[model samples]
Target: MTLFIGFLIGCAFGAILFLGGATSYRRILGTLLLKDLWIIKLMATAIGVGTIGIYALDFVGLANLSVKPVYIGGVALGGLIFGIGWAVSGYCPGTCVVGSAEGKTDAMATLAGGLVGALLFALAIPLLSGALIEPLSFGAVTMPDLLGISGIWLALPFGAALLMVAFVILRERAS
Candidate 1:
């Protein structure tokens, strides 16, 4: 049942990506080149809504929130790799999935490469965890904990900030 629910959600999200032109390599490149702002707006909107919705669920006692330990080195390295992939391929993981669904050969290749990378990472974890993950661990810091405030307090300001940023980006693009 859980897998079914996840599958349905994934399908819906993929459909949304396809319908939004997010699956297009050209659109992704345009976003990177700042010639198009749709993808940025879409991502910003998703982040904003997800932030608010997650917090709202928690506030209403409908969700249990958990924060993973923050490994600074791991995050930095992973982000660098991810940035490289996005810049080179113009397809982030979600977009890659959407493109693959649409039968794009390049996206299929990207997805295969991602799967191989994930497999290699998993295989290397035991060997790399000590040097790459644990030493820089900044244990489970949540915004509420860092700010010394309630989750709602932090979430409202953060969500608002994201929305404001998204609006500014769209407004600038419009001009």
Candidate 2:
């Protein structure tokens, strides 16, 4: 019953992802080209809100930071590489899966490439541990932590940033 429930949840999540255009190659490509940053902005803002909410919950003793130390260098390098590869390939993991379901040959290639890449990364963990690692911000360490200000104080700047991004998107859309 537990396994069946998990399967159903995963199926539901996949359905939502597909319906949300979360797997749309064109939308992903638009982000890279800067032709349409709406999807990118939406994702960024949503993630920001999620991060703040999670931290707030953790502070209230309702949640925990359940992640380990992050490697900053690896993250930066990975993001750079991933962005380039994603732009060139025209599909990401989720999109690739959805496209594969729709019988796309290129999406199949993307999925195969992702599998092989993951396998290679797993095999290279030992070599990468020392060579590519760097100190990363972990825990609920946010601007408030570093600046010694209450989180509520930092919300203003965050709101300003979001507003600026929204303005940029609006201008882009208008022109």
Candidate 3:
């Protein structure tokens, strides 16, 4: 049953990516050039919505969830690395995987880069654990939890923000 559900979700995502033209390196690179960010916006919205929904469900007692609090040093380091890599490669890891599905050879290179990045991280973790690795938390930790607000309450703003971003991205493409 779990396998079937996973397959269905994967298929749904595949169809979405196929229809959205997200599997193209041109579209992914467009974000850097400020040409077209439609695909990037769509993916970001999907992630934001999914995250909000999961948190909402957890608040309602319909789902289980857990999130470790943000580690500033790790977040900063990772963001710097990711930003540099994306700017240099013009394709982030997520976009690269989708592009590979649509036959982008550059996407294949990006995937290789991702693997290399992961390997390097693994290798460095042991040496950096003293300052970088934080202890894991066992239960849900979100904006609402951190701010002492309701999860569903936070969801509204998150969803709205995603919609606004999508609108802006789409509007730019339309113009």
Candidate 4:
């Protein structure tokens, strides 16, 4: 049941991405170049809604929020790699999948490359555990923890701020 629900949600999300033009290489490049705000607005809305929904579920005892451990080196390296890949390929993992679904060859290649990268990272995890994961590790914590406030309290304002950015601050440029 959970798997089925997840599949349905994934389908809905993919449809949304498609409708929002996130599947387009041009759109991705425009975003990277700061000429298009559509994808940024879409992501902002998603994160805003997700933040509110996840915290609401947790508050009501319907979900358990499991925070991942933070490793500075691992995060910095991963972000650098992710940004470079996005800039070079114009397709992040999610968008690549959606583009592949649309039968885009470039997206297919990007997806293949991403899979290879993931495999390499998995294989290198053992070696990275010492240098990147342990020494810099900060046990599972969240912004609320750092600020000494309940997640719901921070989530409300943060989510609202993102929502405002998506709906009010950002405007789609004429193509």
Candidate 5:
């Protein structure tokens, strides 16, 4: 049942990505160039919805909160690599999957590269953990905890902010 539910969710997400034009390399390029705001809007909406849904689930005791250690150096390095990949290949990881499904060779390359990178990271983590992962670790902290606010309180405001961003992007796109 859990597997079936996950499969259904994955299908729905892929359908949304395809229908939203996130799978199109041209559309992704347009987003990178700031010529299109559709992807940004879509992502913002997803984040907003996800934030609210997650917090609601947690509030209702349907979900357990597990926070990962914040490794700022790792995030910065990952973001740099991600930005370069997105700019050069015009496919972020999720879009790469959708693009690959649609027979795009570049997407296939991007997916292959990503898998390779993941494998390499997995292989290297233990070797590099002391220098890379532990240096700047803030252990299991969340924004609400840091700010001394309730999770739900933080989530509502964060969701609202994301919704606002989405609204602005869509409004500008419409105009």
Candidate 6:
């Protein structure tokens, strides 16, 4: 049941991404160039909504929030790699999947590359664990935990701020 629900939600999210032009190289490039803010806005909105929903579910005892460990070096390295890949391919992982579904050859290549990258990362994890995962890891701590507050309390304001960023702050450049 949970898997089915997750699949349905994923389908809805993919459809939203498709409708929002996330599958288009031109649109992605425009975003990278700061000439378009559509994808940014879409992502901000999605994150805001999801954050609030997840926290609310957890608060109501309907969800279990699993926080991942935070390691500064790992996060920085992962982010750098992700950004470079997105800039080079004009497709992030989610968009690549959607674009491949739409029969785009470039997207297919990007997806393949991403899969290969993930496999390589998995294989390297054991070797990298000491250097990347252990010394710097802050075990499963969230902002709310650090601040000694309820997640829902922080989530409400943070989510609202992101929603404002999406709907009110970010604007498309005149092009």
Q: Could you arrange the candidates by lDDT from highest to lowest?
A: 6, 4, 5, 1, 3, 2
Which residue pairs clash within candidate 4? none
Q: Could you give candidate 5's per-residue lDDT for residues 51-99 as a string of tens digits?
A: 9988988988988888888888788888999999888888889889988
Q: 101-174 in candidate 6: lDDT tens per residue? A: 99999999999999999999999999999999998998998888889988999999989999998877885332
Comparing 3 and 4 on lDDT, the stronger one: 4
Question: Could you tell which candidate, 2 or 6, scores higher by lDDT?
Answer: 6
Candidate 4: residue 174 lDDT (0-100): 24
Q: Give a tens-digit lDDT track for model 1, residues 86-109.
A: 877778999999898889998988
| Model 1 accuracy (lDDT, Cα) | 0.84
My TM-score estimates for the predictions, one after another, are 0.91, 0.64, 0.76, 0.93, 0.91, 0.93
lDDT of each: 0.84, 0.68, 0.73, 0.89, 0.86, 0.90
TM-score computed on alpha carbons, candidate 2? 0.64
RMSD of each: 1.8, 4.6, 3.5, 1.5, 1.7, 1.6
- lDDT tens digits, residue span 1-175, model 4: 9899989989999999999999887787787788888899999999999999889888789889889999999999999999998877788899999999999998899999999999999999999899999999999978889998778888899999999988888854423
Stretch of 10 with least lDDT, candidate 2: 134-143
Model with the higher lDDT, candidate 1 or 2: 1
Where does candidate 3 stray beyond 4 Å?
134-141, 167-169, 172-175
User: With candidate 6 superimposed using the best TM-score fit, by how many Å does residue 5's alpha carbon deviate from the native?
Assistant: 0.6
Q: Please list the residue runs of candidate 2 whose C-alpha ends up more than 4 Å from where it truly belongs after superposition.
A: 1-17, 70-72, 98-103, 134-144, 148-175
Strongest candidate by lDDT: 6
What stretches of model 6 exceed 4 Å from their correct place? 171-175
* lDDT-superior candidate, 3 or 5: 5
RMSD of model 4, in Å? 1.5
Q: TM-score: which is higher, 2 or 6?
A: 6
